[model samples]
Target: MKINRCGQAEALTKEMFQKVLGEIKNDSHRLIFALCWYTTERPSAILQLQVSDVYGSARVPLEKMVIAARTRKDKKTREVPIATALRQELKAYSAPSEGYLFPGRAGHLTFSAYDKGLRRVFEKLGLRGFSTYSTRRGSLTTLSRSGAGIRQIQALSGHASLGNLQRYIEVSDSEVAAIAAML
Candidate 1:
């Protein structure tokens, strides 16, 4: 794992992810975190999403939500397939017409605000070492453990390179032992 000044964010289990979701009372906030997990998109990019980006003209959720190049860290446009859970959230969410999905003073919801909200949820749930980026990291790790290839994950995450993407994947000792036993 790549160590950074702030330390790696803790990747959550499916149960922990669900706990976090249940803790968030606001529908928009819940959807935001769900998108973070399901889309593996950064909080900033998800916050900046326009209504049309995730919906069709008929107001149905798009099979793949468009992450414009301008909003992506890699400056490459990506189309992330919406997971069934996230599709349900989108169906229930009241996305604004022709504007930012999470509207704020400057246009979209600020990263700071999102972070603060998540921090509160984490604290209430007694979760530690989790951050706004945790869902993205957790989702990536979950996909890796579920037998997704590096290239396939890279396509979804829009990482600049495989090495960068690898840094996000976490391997537990139990998984290592299981692999050894199989071998």
Candidate 2:
């Protein structure tokens, strides 16, 4: 894994992501990370999600989950389609009727609290440099590798600009070699 500046978190490969997810024994915490991975949202926005934003009257997962504008770094609300993995996690979790999904005394789950739990998981797995942002960056990189258009990823991630979004994508050496061969 490449070490980046303070603001940048190392992106995990899909296998590494699964390993991290499996290490998380807490159901709520597992769901939290799954939401982060699948929705490609920041941990703060994911933590602030209202139960209604994810579930309907019968506690069914919505097709699209809303990341509230207020919690977003760019303050732009985006509806992310729930991936199958995230939907399964949501189903396993018993969500409350209303209010924050991960509620804390201060209103919603504090970033520090979430980070603490994440840090423990990482330490146990001997992973260094991975943060809550890892999932978001990983998801974007995965999308880019899968041939999704940069504009599509930008929309999904709600990035203010393509340049900012591009920074999150990690180009593999093999991918570069393949492009060189094509040339």
Clashes of each: 0, 0
Write down the TM-score of every candidate: 0.91, 0.92
User: Model 2 over residues 21-131: C-alpha lDDT tens digits?
Assistant: 999987768888999888888888888889989998799999999888988888888999988888988999988778988878988778888888988998899888888
The global C-alpha lDDT for each of the candidates, from Candidate 1 onward, is 0.87, 0.87
Score residue 86 of candidate 2 by CA lDDT. Answer: 82
Those runs of model 1 whose alpha carbons end farther than 4 Å from true positions after fitting are 1-5, 181-183
- Judge candidate 1 at residue 47 and give its lDDT: 88
TM-score of 2: 0.92
lDDT tens digits by residue: candidate 1, 69-164: 888887888888998998999999887777888888988988888888888998898788888888988999999989998899998888888998
Worst 10 residues of 2 by lDDT: 1-10
